[model samples]
Target: MRPRYTVVASLSRLHRTFLTAPSSSDEGFDFIFYMTNKAKSINKALNDAVPLCNNPLVLKIHEAMRYTLLSGGKRVRPMLCLAACELVGGQESTAVPGACAVEMIHASSLIQDDLPCMDDDSLRRGKPTNHKVFGEDIAVLTADALIALAVKKLASSTSFGVSPERVLRAVLEMAKAVGTEGLVAGQAADLAGEGMSLEENEVGLKHLEFIHIHKTAALLEAAAVIGAIIGGGSDEEIERLRRYARCTGLMFQVVDDVLDVTKSSEELGKTAGKDLIAGKMTYPRVMGVEKSREYAEKLNREAREHLQGFDSNKVAPLLSLADYIVNRQN
Candidate 1:
């Protein structure tokens, strides 16, 4: 077992590592400054959305939820959502609720995935897993609460100046990502794929893609598409962003799989090499490290290609984000 001090990554340490600025080729774009500002905004919105209070009743559940939701990560999914919204000429404010909702859903997934019954992980985001810190029962309740609260957030989208129809579309789109079509399907497949020797499996690559596309990429795709929908993007624009998000999301996982081995737990803020130890199918295991890196690059290029024809100015954040995913050390 890891020492107690090592089990829970300090918020400050995780932030410095997780939120490092993305590299930008355009000298004109201050990616660092832009990310810092947006990170603060997203963090504040999330905090307001899930504040801990001595609710004469549900305090521990709220604590568990906040422990994961507010714990630092790159916030890539919500950032993608906001960037897609801005890419379609919408105000950042218009996408904040959707952004927060996507993040909550993402956090909910992470918490449940860390449960003893799921990934059975004890560490996440450099912190103790929800089930490790809170009891398993409370952790389960926390995940459920976050999902319900996320739905509540999207349910009130009209208050944010979004039309009811747009909100409904976004809600439905996000629902598909969380249910059988997305995270759930991917996770179930991942569990089934565990301990399978990739070399013996003729369809390893195909199975790997299936796992991540659903597990990691689906919510990201929904986040971007829903943001565009909320922002009143044209159908073509929404689809373009959807494609971009899918590619970016996949690339994010490819990089994550690679980092799982090359980086230490301290570097990643989570247990490192768990994938290898678990005999999980990962890019580095199936395609080799060099090939996995190449695939990530290909996915990044495709993600950027989907942004073609959009106003270059509007695409800046998304482009940097793709770069971030491919380039992140963690």
Candidate 2:
């Protein structure tokens, strides 16, 4: 089938835009400053969205939800959603609901993923897995609650200034990212690949890409696309953001695989070298470490090319974000 969207501009035009130097104001743009401020904003919204002590009967599950959802991490997905919205000239307030919804979905996935039936991980984000702390049953329900609450937040929490149609579109994008076509599909493939013998090199690059694209990139794609939709970006503009998100999302997984080997347990805040021990299909495993690094660089470049036509100052956050993904130790 043909893709939903294709590049609207020629390669020359994209490269010229990519190579244009950032203006003086953008030169001084501080990633730490932006990240800190955005993280604070997101945290506040998330806290308000999923308030603890709401009801005595469900307090246990609520705790489990917040334990994982609010745990400190980079908050990359939500940040991307907000940044994409601003990139298209939308107010940050308009995107806050969508941003929080994406994070809830992301956190829900991690909770389920760390269960004994899945990755069987004991640690995540520098703490015990939700299932480990709250037991498997609560952890499962926690995932369910978060998914439902995420949709609720998206449908109800967005400002009335945004049209109902736009909010519905954003919710639809978020739903797609979580269902059979997105995270679940990628995870299922990943598990199936793990069941095969590690000695076999049949797990090729194409297969690896499929797994990562669906597993990791799917939600990230939704993040950017939903933001653009909420921000009222044109079809062509939304498509470009999707392309940028897809590249960075894949880069995220590739870099993660590399970090699994290169970083220590203390550094990564989780088990180090776990992927190698598990013999999971990864870019480093298939293409070798050096080639994987090269591939990461290529993906980063391709993602930046998609950002070319946008205002330079407006895109500084995303441009810095791409670089951050490549170089982040964890």
Candidate 3:
């Protein structure tokens, strides 16, 4: 028989070969070229602002928070927040805290979603998942703490000096985004419906809409609306921003479904095709792949169109962001 080392080497080569195998549908969004400046600016802002949570308890929570938050993501939510603020004529400094708050909440949800009871993902952003690194109990507690801290930071951040009413509004919107009405409900439904079959009927559509609108789109909508509110935007501006956010949210989920079939685990920085494995309802699984791609592009166009009322310079990032969302590979 061949030596054990040789067998191991051969298996490694096979794994690499599998990963690099070309797919027929190899089109992937060139994210580096598309969002280079926006990504860099967002990262710099997040790194600088995240370290400022100075209280020991907050700092401990921030440690767990940074474990995942700083772990490399597209920074889409925070970018939405900052873009919404800028669209309303607010400076980046004035909006950084809200951006950070949204990011924290997003990170917490990711952590919870990766727990054993949920997706049980072992990796995220190409690294060991939060539960994998810190143990499930601590990971769960950490996520809970970060959620609370996000609200606390929003309340205390003096840069915005937002009215108590607006701050409360932000909290309520965030609660709706992440509470039973939002991400949590979506997650529960996703898990509960695993391996369930849906006929082409109204019930299927209801399940699909609930999973997409609540689990994915709600937080994104909150990010845009909250950023606008914090920046003192008018009612009309808020309405427009909501429309943009909802469109982008749906677009984001469609692209995610596309990526699930087209991308690899390494490219996604997490398991690919898990949606099918989990039997979760997805656009690609519901609509055919070609139709799903077309739908995503349509929503992307609509999202960009919603921003036309704002100054071109102010809305450039948001427009580019919509394109980037539909076009992302991972």
Specify the highest-lDDT model's number.
Answer: 1
State every prediction's TM-score relative to the real structure. 0.92, 0.90, 0.83
Top-TM-score candidate index:
1
Q: TM-score of predicted model 3?
A: 0.83
| Model 1 vs. true fold: TM | 0.92
Flag regions of model 3 displaced more than 4 Å.
1-62, 198-203
Candidates' RMSD to native: 3.4, 9.1, 7.6
Q: After TM-score superposition, what is the CA distance of residue 99 in candidate 2 from its true location, in Å? A: 0.2
lDDT of 3 by residue, 1-330 (tens): 433222233233323433454322213433234344445665675576457476975565566667887776666787788778778976665666777778888989999999998888897766788988878877898899778867876776454677777767777888889899898998887777677776642256577778878888888998898888777788898889988998899889988888888889866657899888887778877786899899988897788778878876567667766766666555
Clashes counted in candidate 1 amount to 1
Order of models, best TM-score first:
1, 2, 3
Off by over 4 Å in 2: 1-26, 198-203
Please identify which of the two predictions, 1 or 2, would achieve the higher TM-score against the true structure: 1
lDDT of 1 at 183: 94
